[model samples]
Target chain A: MKYLRLVLRSFLRSKRRTVLTILSITVSVALIAILQSILATLNAFANNPDASNRIVVRHKVSITNLLPTRYADWLRQQPEVESVMGLQWFQGVYIDRSNFFPNFASEAEFVNTVFKEEIVEYSDAQFREFLRDRNGALVGKNLADKYGWKLGDVVSLKSELFPITVRLTIRCIFRSKRPADELALHFNYKLLEEGVSYMKGRVGTFFVRVHRADDVPKLIERIDRHFHDAVEPTYSETENAFQLEFLKMMGNYSAIIQMITGAVLVAILIVTANTMAMAIRERTTEISVLRAIGFRTSQILAMLMGEGILLSVLGGAGGLAIAWLLAGAVRGYVGTFLPYLQNFHIDAGTMSLCFHATLAVGTLSTFIPAYRAARRPIVDGLRSL
Target chain B: MSGEPIIRLRGLAKSYYRESLEIPVLQGIDLEIPAGGYYALMGPSGSGKTTLLNLIAGIDRPTGGELEVCGHTLNGLDDDELAAWRSTYVGFIFQNYNLVPVLTAFENVELPLLLTPMSRRARREKVEEALAHVGLTEWMEHYPRQLSGGQEQRVAVARAIVGDPELLVADEPTGALDHKNAEEIMALMEGLNRDLGKTIVMVTHDPKAAHHARHQIHLEKGVLDRTIEVNR
Candidate 1:
């Protein structure tokens, strides 16, 4: 504690250099925090705890391939399954092609059962109305709020994949735990099938809800085996695994992000190490004077390293504050393209990782230079005078 | 200035090496200065007077021969042990008055005491007393850059004596000072020796500064040339 003033004074000796170094670390660490938060958001999307009791059954070929609608009936008849719904992705655009969001043609009657975890709130009467009207649509709260949509508001979507323009009347607006899940709209599959002749008896996937989470594995095996020799083979997995498969289709995003983060960390380490080395080198005479005045080498080394760590921690703290302040804007901007990042914010785990990373960089970058400076012979140091 | 000498040297030798080539700076020398004696070492630039002062102060090791000062065998102590010994027994005032520029006079003087188990209050008190002794109590809050060359040297002197070490070694303490400041610093050193009974060993090329010492030991080419007792 007595040496703190000495370390601080030495650190502040070169104000411009110190501030520049700290800014470098701050910018780099902020970049790292944002990147790690994005990765964490994606991971949370792929590993949602609420998805444990749900399973997804898709065609054996690819996600784009459609499965027979009878597969949902077969899944519902299974003793382990509690509810099943056929879901078909409606790749559509609104007024502008840039205004894109996930729209799905879904079985309306079983939505409340199959996605019980997702539909946090909705009016029972509005849901019944959606079930009755062929053009009625169930919009997520975020999707509705985004487009200023309300009950009885008619919204039209032009689908390029299926030669049809379906005009849907918003009957219900539902909320969900995850923001990404609340950025979607679902209309009755009957409306889509009646408009497009080829999509009438086919679904992109079947989402099944089981009574018990433990029954999911067995139910998935049973469903796949039942359709193994059928005209279209089925691939069944837990909802979490399905989400992970979708993430995989994005081409090893996690590894790419991690590599980029690692590269940034290394670059910051080099810059910080150079700054510390130069600072210590500049104070060669001062260090020798301290040694001559009876300070031990270890004491000198500790003081130097303390200065480096203090610099890094200050930058790290600044970076975190900046990242936190900008998180909302990042979520809104990036989430437009990638819905999974709508829930993007720095989590506790990411904060901890960044904090530890700064500490490691501080310690590692300062060690060699501080040790060399401290271990230098006092006579040699004095000779510089 | 009788009884056993506070500093004793027998065949003290020091050498520097540059890639296997040896450069002998100080060759076989025998010397002693009794307790409370004020002496000066005077020689040419390469006469190795500063080297001898460094060795006696325990800042540098004698590569080949036995060296002892203030009852501790310096040759037997490691770097850390020597540092501990120096904190307790020896004080140094460099040619440049190497007070830490970032620290105030009080903090600079309080540095050596930080190595001890002294409380902050005690350290502050001792620093205040030391600065007062150098007649710079009013300037204790000032930094080295803010002080004149003589005042900086005085702060260096205060830092040297704050720990109450038995010996004080100065390497051209007033080399950078003008005539007036040099005289003032020499007077301060004289008072420290005469009134406080400190053993002072200083290295100086300035004949006027060397005249202030009780005895001057002249060295020529790493060997003692003569010892002259000054008739003050």
Candidate 2:
């Protein structure tokens, strides 16, 4: 502890160099922290704790392939299935492509039952009004606020994939338990069925709530087997697995992101090592003087290592703070493109990972240079200057 | 005090090797200084005066012969052991004063004592006493940069004696000082030797500085040339 001041003073011997080195580390650590946070958020989506009792049934051919709407009746007949809702994705643009949000058409009755977890608050009269009007719609609080929408406001969207435009009056605005769940709009599926001839008897997917979580695997196999010979075969899996399949559509980019993170850390290590090497080389004579004054080699090495670790940790901590602050802004930006990132944040787990990474970088960068400097003969070091 | 020599060198030798070239710096040197003796080593450049002083201080090892100081055989001691020996028995003063620039006078003077098992309060007391002896007690909080060259050297002197080591080895302690500061440092060193009973071994090229010692030994080309007794 007494040597801490000496180590710090020596580190600040070149104030500009130290500050610059710390900034470099801060930038890299921030980048790394953000990347790791994104991966964690994606993983959380894939393994959502709330989705354990739910399963999704889609066409076996592909997600783009549609399944018969009557399949929900067959799923509900199974003892394992408790409730079922038919969901069809409607790819429509509001004013521009940049103002994107998830818009889906699902059964209006199931909105207040099967998806009770998502709706934090909504009055019974507002939902009855939605059912009473054929062109009525329900919007999430986040989506409504983004467009300054309120009850009775008419929301219109032009379909890019279809030859029709949707105009509906907003009758319900609901808050969600999760931030990401609040960036969506759901309208009655009957509107799409009555308007479009192609979607009259089909739905994009079927969301089923199972009676028990432990029976999910067996129920998935049973449902898939029952429709094996059907004209439009069905595929069944847990809701978490279905979300993971969507995530997997981007391919196995997790490995690529990890590789990029590794490359960034290596670059940071080199920069830090070079800075530390130069700092130690310039102090050769001073180190020799310390040796002459009864400082042993271990003491000298410890001092240098201490200084290096301090610099790296400071930079890392600063970077983490920056990452934490930028999380919400980045999520808002990404929410425009990927709706699931609306809840982006640096969780406690990622913070711990980054803290450990900072210490590791510190140790790796300084060990070789500090050891070399400490091991040099005292006479040679004294004569260096 | 015992009449036996505190420092003894028997046929001491040191050499440097650059690839295949061998350069001898000191050869066939035999020397002894009794307890509380004040001696100055005088020679030309490359005459091995500093090299011999380093050998006696246990900072450097003899190449071919036995060397002993403060009753410890230095030839077989490893680097760590030598460092421990120096901490216990020897104190060093360099021409550059060599106080750490970042540390204040009190901290610099307290450095050698850090090697011991002394408590912080004990170390502080020792540092204050040493600084008082050097008449720099009031300047304890000043850094080396804030002090004059003479004051810096005095702080260095305080650092050297703070641990109360048995021998003081100074390599041209006043070489970088002005004439007035040099005389003042010599007077202070003379008082340390005469009053505190410290065995002093100094290496210098200035005759004025060498005259302050009780005896002067001259070397030429890595060999002893002559010894003179000073009367003052």
In candidate 1, chain A reaches a TM of 0.97
Writing each residue's lDDT as its tens digit, candidate 2 over B61-139 gives 7788889899999999988888888888888888988888889999999989888899999999999999999999899
Error of 1 at A287 (Å): 0.5
lDDT of 1 by residue, B166-185 (tens): 99999999899999999999
Best by DockQ: 1
The worst-scoring run of ten residues by lDDT in candidate 1 chain B lies at B1-10
Assess the local accuracy of residue B145 in candidate 2 as a C-alpha lDDT between 0 and 100. 93
Provide TM-scores for the models. Answer: 0.97, 0.94
lDDT accuracy of residue B76 in candidate 1:
91
Question: A184-235, model 2: which lDDT tens digit per residue?
Answer: 8888899889888899889989989877899999999999999999999989
Candidate 2: Cα lDDT at A338: 90
C-alpha lDDT (0 to 100) for residue B53 of candidate 2? 90
Looking at candidate 2 chain A, the ten consecutive residues that score lowest on lDDT are A111-120
How large a fraction of the reference contact set does each model reproduce?
A: 0.69, 0.40
